[model samples]
Target: KEFTYLIFPLLCFFYDKNTRRKEKNKRHCFLSVPRWVSLSLSMCLSQTLNRSKMNHIPIPITCQNDTEMSSRDIDYTVNALEVERILNYHFKNKRLVEDALTHSSYTDSVSYERLEFLGDSALGLVLSIYLFLTYPNLDPGQLSLLRASNISTEKLARVAIRHGLYRFVRHNASTALDDKVREFAEAVSQEDDPLIHGGTVKAPKILADIVESLAAAIYVDVDFDLQRLWVIFRGLLEPIVTLEDLQQQPQPVTMLFELCQKNGKQVDIKHWKNGSKYIASVYVDGNFIASGSSEQKEIAKLNVAKLSLHKLSDSRPTKMEGLENTGELDGKSEIEGAKQKLHELCRKKKWPKPSYNIKDEGPSHEKKFECSVQIVTADSMLSMTGDEKSRVKDAENSAASLMIHLLQESDYL
Candidate 1:
């Protein structure tokens, strides 16, 4: 009877009302069950019920139409429409606009990747043609540099921020991205120059991709007409880098190398990677001049070279009028004497020992050592780099001598 009672509940839970009713009717015709059987059935039914509840699976929620969308999706759609208004050109296929702004993180649907690729090629071609026509006399090298500056990632990102295109980018990335975009926008706002590259600030790549994808979308919508695409986008890429700008601000490495060569000196660049970042050190005539760190190896090298060039310019002799000729002071004895004097001065002043950073450049047969020295005193700190030396000790001595001369001239000795 107990087992029968337990089984009854199990049957009720498993079967629908009609099925349970039919089964109950059929059970009534059977002989009465024992109480133990009823109890056992009830226990089994309860266990089954608990197990079912524990194992319940939830149905995924999906939106079939705009009415079913959450407030966030609605806002996203509205912003997409506003983008068209901002551009003042409606996308014939509205999906293209959405595709341009849709980052890979946003949805599994089409993303900006394809469009970005297309836009990259289109942008390069357009810039090449524009530059070729604008500067007929400019060589291929100059034209290439000019085009690169005008349509670079930094330049496009700047354009996106200036025109408020980033706000429309549909990305599902973390709030960190929002913060980065905000920071980049603020940085651009503070910048005075309109045509910016990566020199002053680093621009986010996503912002640049959005601009390129949009350009590609425009090209596709206009039946792959390059002229039509240019007509729409030429003004958007304002303050194009001209030949004059390139001449005024040649690449840092180029400028530095040229300056060194003109003065009958050699420039060397050495770099190493630290995790994901790169550290670059510049040596002018075998002397450690400056160092820079960046996420990119090329950028780091450029920065180090630029700093070295600036230091060289600042240290150039202003008036060679009354100073002792110090003609070709590259001998071993002269360097040793200068190093001894620098050490004595530091000891007399009770200053900490001066430190030197040295680097070697060139082949084994023609190795050159560059050294940088920093001397910190009670009143001030002095840093100087010496001309390159054939030996490490000589480089150190040369650096010490340069610092001593600079200190005496500055009246700090």
Candidate 2:
């Protein structure tokens, strides 16, 4: 009778447990559990079955989620479709792309931080491989520099802006971000040099994060295929900086130092901060030659260097003639009064007067404007648009400056 009672209770317990397992499987079919949890459970179940001497019978283990889409995921899917269109590549898992574009500020969802971390390493590795294979003649140092420049935060940020990838990012409304993005965009639009490290404004890291996170999203979507990642990114990062570009346009600071060294003059740069602005002064042989200011210390230094180069070159035109002729020296000073310069150039060439189109955007209190210049030709339309600025004139000048630089570089000035 005691043996019968024990068997009855054991049978009831097994029946209840099996019923619960089946119900659980029905409710959760997504199987989103971590790998370690699945492994641990499998081991425990195996040991229990072995001890119980029921190894002949099979026990099923499953963990899953409901197939119905969550409201949040549905919203993400819409955005994901737009992003996929921009990337020209569809995603097998839309959630990955959604997570990539989401900033940490957006609560209750996965952020791009983890994906950015993965992408940082993956991007570096892929770029290193490309550099290694593409330029077999380049030494390690040269290759390292190329890799670093190509994968730099500034470069990636530029790529994000150039490709309009920033528009898809999901983040909380941030005034600081808006201002930074606006300033950087303006700087980029005004800049005509592709090989330059960055434009007048410092690039925001958020932009770079978006790019890296997107790269990781693609990498994961392609099953961690580095080759596939490269194929997608190669086109996104257009106008890749080449060895010739690097050699032709060295860093402004480096160029200035070399110029001074050749002339037996000591180059000294001093930096300080005034309010939100960082100021840099260029001193040659203990005499202050020129000064420049920016929101970034490095950019301020570079600005002063370029300004000093202009001053030095003008002071000894004959000595710097060779450098200027070879296009090593920046003709950046000509960009000043760029509107007038463009008008004069058009008048001189007997081309139609450059036409301007202005756009005003943002809140009234913090309004921004952008300008685009177009010069219609018989066979083509040459146009340039500047980054948004606080003033319409500044925006117009920025656009004109870019156009002027392009013309000068093409030997049409």
Candidate 3:
């Protein structure tokens, strides 16, 4: 009799799932079952239902247009519309949006993993096309750097936090995801730069995943129009980094290497663990310049690099006189008379004079001169090599031009 009672509920559930859509009136027929049995079945369905079991036994899950939805369904739909308002792009299918926000922790329905995968690809393509069109002269390498900076885990996670997208994520109530997200939010609130990656608190990947999944939902809803996707979400991705922005935030490690190379000195950065924090020590020519420690190794490296720059700055030569200050530096002057301009900049900045190195190549009739220009900053010496030219003077000018451009990009100018 106990077995019969258990089996009866399963039969009733299967019947309810199969008949609920076909004949709405017949759905009530399962209500005729005993109260305790109905309660037990409802509890089981709510807790254990998944697609794999549904394929085997046909458990009734909610349909797209079911009039009688649970309170949870209504909440998800409302959240979807709110997100639509935030994104300024209405979804034809609210289900996709709901799915995007639904974390794997939520047991009732689909998660955003698949949508995130699609969105990741779509976002990359859209950003690539935008960069290519917007910056006609940028090399593929530079374009790639810009795209990466914009879509990085830190960048996208900041987007989610900045726009309150994190509020829409549906996760298990028992999980600690909310606490971690709150902690991250609090940490980033103090940051001045929205796109900065190296911070005291690392960005939780789930926040980034939410942005990607939402993007995928929009892409799918709009029939995969790459341009339309950009048009819709461009505002959300505000303050997109441009070439100038990219130049402003130079990689400290690369700059350090270039600086040491120009000075004919070797550079080395050593990493070690000091208790819970990571420590990075910057060395030039086997001498320790500065050290920085952080919770993350990369952040420590960057900190040390900045410190090293300051240290080198203090040891640089005093400013030389008699060079005219050409107001603010621009690209045209850097190319027109790069050699003289570099000398003027070195004088104005109170740094060491610029030095040029030349290499001759090819046969005498088709000879070429490759020039490398070097200059000392406050803490380090930096070098820039120009394209080979037929004459030594032209090569020297080219090298100086490249050096000026490097300084501009690195914000040294």
Candidate 4:
């Protein structure tokens, strides 16, 4: 009888277990959790994935509300089709390109500043290398002058505008692009037909900024290889970059003989002509020793030659100890090793130079007293002359010191 009772309970327990499972499964079916969740998750995933497939080319600023029919939309400067064409030509990495076209003014979420920084550096390196290899005989100063002029913001902007960059740039919804940039660009484009050019010009700075941003965009895209950059650069600089023309670019030192060895064209540098009537002058970086201007191209060329000679004269250094010998004044190392040596010698002779009046000048723990000693020692130059034993050598050293000072001031060093 007991066995029968236990079997009955066991049977009941098995029935209960099956009942609970059925109820749980029934709940699952009613909620449709598996089907619904899967669908939502998949849709979200697809949008994320599709972003990669679509190139970042901008939609036309004019097409913001494209009912497909109105040319009256002047709300934004750049158009979608123009952006698409430019990006399609230059960018391979769709994702990278999108990031580049996105102006900070367009949205608060992302920016291209980092990409801009990177692109600017890359362009500079590439252009410098091109100049180096192309003008193998050119001196360092000449190469740098060419590179700087070529890679300048204004030049880049002009290129961008020619390639339809203005079509992609979006201004604040409220403010149209500055009128100056528009006017200058129009004027340049329509040089042959001033009435058609509308005499509109864009601000040089604005145009350039947009161009740099575009370069950064192209850099992010995989399609823009070194060859592509070179091609673009060559086309843009074609007017000025011929072998013969490069010779006319300034040489702060004598490079005429070496220039002659390059591809033979009459070594002439003429003022570069764009649609604008602006003058181009050469300087070794920013230090200007000469200026030249003329209506005739050869006249302008002669002026550059004279300027190069002037540059040579201005730098006529009596103390041209090739960088290896500038000692403490070498290049950018401003540390005063000689001064410290002098101070130690003075200390040994019981003539410890006084400490510096100011303190904490650099990265070292070099005390204010050490700097003061240097200053005081410099002031005590007269006292050292009095010692008769060292009088003759002292005068000679003083004369040498005076010569060094004179050389520094003369510019003909």
Candidate 5:
């Protein structure tokens, strides 16, 4: 009798389980349980089957959503299709597109969190490859800066706004987000300078994420085809910053450091907190050049650098009279003139002689030499390269002349 009662309970348990499974399958709802819960249930069922000497059957968990789409979901699908059109590529799995556009705040079936993670890495790789091939002469540091400027939040957000990608993002953020989007759109429309390398504008991160997630979605849809992904996105990321652009107006901090190093001045950046704002001061050769304050230390530093640059420009002498007065340019060849001026400046500053590195290229009969002059200041090393010349001495002289001209322009001489 007791055994019969045990069998009855087991039958009831199986019948309830079967009923629930049928209902779930009919509704087409995914069964998402915690990992711990699933493991605990599996172990308990295995133990029970072992005790009864019966074969253990594994339970199948469905990860797909089989349920009917709500009105909102249908709208999301339509919007996603429009996004696909904007992207100029179709997804074999449409769910990937939907997931990419859905933000965590939406509380939908799934968000773009996973895809965003994947997209971040993919975007970095694509940009790295693009910059590396496009700028063959750029060093690793220059390549990094170029990549960072392109993939920055402001730049990516600008991309999203330009391509209408932000319209398809399924987010439930506050009105502030909408306001920010509108403001950003307006800012972009009125922007005379589109480059975000100066860090003057504030961009919403979600807009950037949308761009990245979509990139990831396309990558996955194409089965991780990086070349195809670049082809599609290269146009979307228009006005690609080139090496010339970076050199024309390098980052303020970089410009300041280079100027200080070339002028044999030491640059020191000091930071402090003033209530809620952060303050940064730039010191050149023990003198306080300029100070700036902002909520962010980086911005503050940039501002200080800009101010210092202005100060240096205003204080610079207009003529090369100092070089003439040094008695280094008396009846000498142009090459000797350049070398003597550089040596005199180094001696005045009590610094070591500048180093010259020369390289010869081409055949023996048509050989060309390239020279680079490296000046070691107290705090930094400033290097400048000159054009190729037929003679090594000419190349070195060209480098030295270039250095002197630069120093004069920056008011160092």
Candidate 6:
């Protein structure tokens, strides 16, 4: 899990025509949008200021009920109300926010992976529009940088954090206890640390992802009613600036560091075989994140790691292809990474030594090969199965448990 703030109330800055915010704020407490965002938004307003139609205005919230939002919850709470207000303000579409917050870590009854994908693209488009229109004066390079800066994971996570979004996240307990959500705590309360001891990191990533996915949702929702979107974007951004200024710089993913939290996640050299091809897997907390069968594992690791990192949100859209397809970074794959850090526990116990072997065990031997993982006594693998996942833990029997975990794990490729 990665770890990583505060600002303007969206209400004051966004809706100049004033209809809902005033009506809304009295009934509920909405989260704040950071002042930094205003810089990009202001740039857009500068250009549209004179246009009677484009200048600051207000539009209807469209959604009167949040049933769709609540349905996404595994255990609903008042946070659904918070999501409702934010979604209403930004997308004027509540469904997107609900989907973005869905976590794959939740029980089978809940998970938001598909929604996360859609939201990811949606945020990208919104960021692009915010940059382009805001910076009528900037060249392409400057616009790119500015957009990248705002849309990066760090920034997006901050957006979610500032608004008290994490308190609403759904995941196993370990994650809820992590510092991953600290940055998202309100002005008063602080969240815990950002490392997933077990399977909870999934929760934090989903929360961070919702920030951008929701942004994307707002963009798409706005398309049907541009004026309404503009007003909401205005409230969300008002504390930042005239839209024109936001376009002056570029936005980059590097601005965010929450993804860099203490999971022992890092890029390392690794190799695997897919038919005659060589592939690589990136590991975090001793678990495979994304893997590739490539001639160059280093580059493959980076590409897959980046893609997996980008896919943190449940709202994100992921493509499926067989494992053999992942070796090429440009191609898509249906592969899933390691189950959780149970593999980390095994590695900690040093139950199995790391060994790289290259033998073409034919497909016919798949079952026998899997069963023999422990017979070789070389290494153990751990994975998360939906039902029993929570039972695997760092415990009194951790050493033996580690061995057991490794015996069940799968190497990513």
Over the stretch 124-235, how does candidate 2's per-residue lDDT look in tens digits? 9999998889998999977876776788778999988887877777888678887998878876775544534554457898898898999998987775779999998778
TM-scores of all predicted structures: 0.55, 0.56, 0.54, 0.38, 0.54, 0.36
Give the higher-lDDT candidate: 1 or 4: 1
Model 6: residues >4 Å from true position, as ranges? 1-77, 86-97, 108-110, 183-204, 216-227, 237-413
- Report, for every candidate in turn, its global Cα lDDT versus the true structure: 0.70, 0.72, 0.73, 0.43, 0.71, 0.41
Q: Tell me the lDDT of model 6 at 263.
A: 30
After the best TM-score superposition of candidate 3, give how far the Cα of residue 284 lies from its true spot, in angstroms.
Answer: 7.3
Highest lDDT among the candidates is held by which one? 3
TM-score, predicted candidate 1 vs. hidden true structure: 0.55
Clashing pairs in 5: 28-67
Model 1 spans > 4 angstroms off: 1-77, 270-281, 291-298, 310-413
- The sequence of per-residue lDDT tens digits that candidate 4 reaches over residues 1-413 is 34434443433344345577765754454355454443443333334334434564432111112244334233322344356565455433333444455556766324556667767776788788888888889889768767755665545666666776655554454444546666567546633211110112323555655656666655445334666665554554334444333332222223432322232423333257645332345454345545555543433444465445434433444233322145423333222343344434445544423111111223334321111111112112111111111222232233333323332443422
- Give lDDT: candidate 6, residue 10: 46
TM-score of 3: 0.54
Q: Count the backbone clashes (under 3 Å) in each candidate.
A: 23, 6, 5, 27, 1, 64
Candidate 6: tens digits of C-alpha lDDT, residues 1-413: 01101222343355454677664652242323233344333323433443444344543223433334354343454565667675556333444555556565666433556546755665556567876876788788666655554554444555565566666666665644556465234311311212111111122455556665555456555543444555565454323322333322101122112343423335343567677567766555565556544343333443454444433321122221121135322222212322133334335643322211111224533411111111111221221112112112211122233323334333321
- Candidate 3 regions exceeding 4 Å error are 1-63, 66-68, 173-175, 265-413
Best by TM-score: 2
Q: Candidate 4, which segments miss by more than 4 Å at Cα? A: 1-81, 87-92, 173-176, 190-203, 223-413
Per-residue CA lDDT of model 5 for 293-379, tens digit only, reads 877676677778767776675466633334444644344334566866786787687554565556677997998988876564444
Candidate 5 ranges with C-alpha deviation above 4 Å: 1-68, 270-281, 286-413
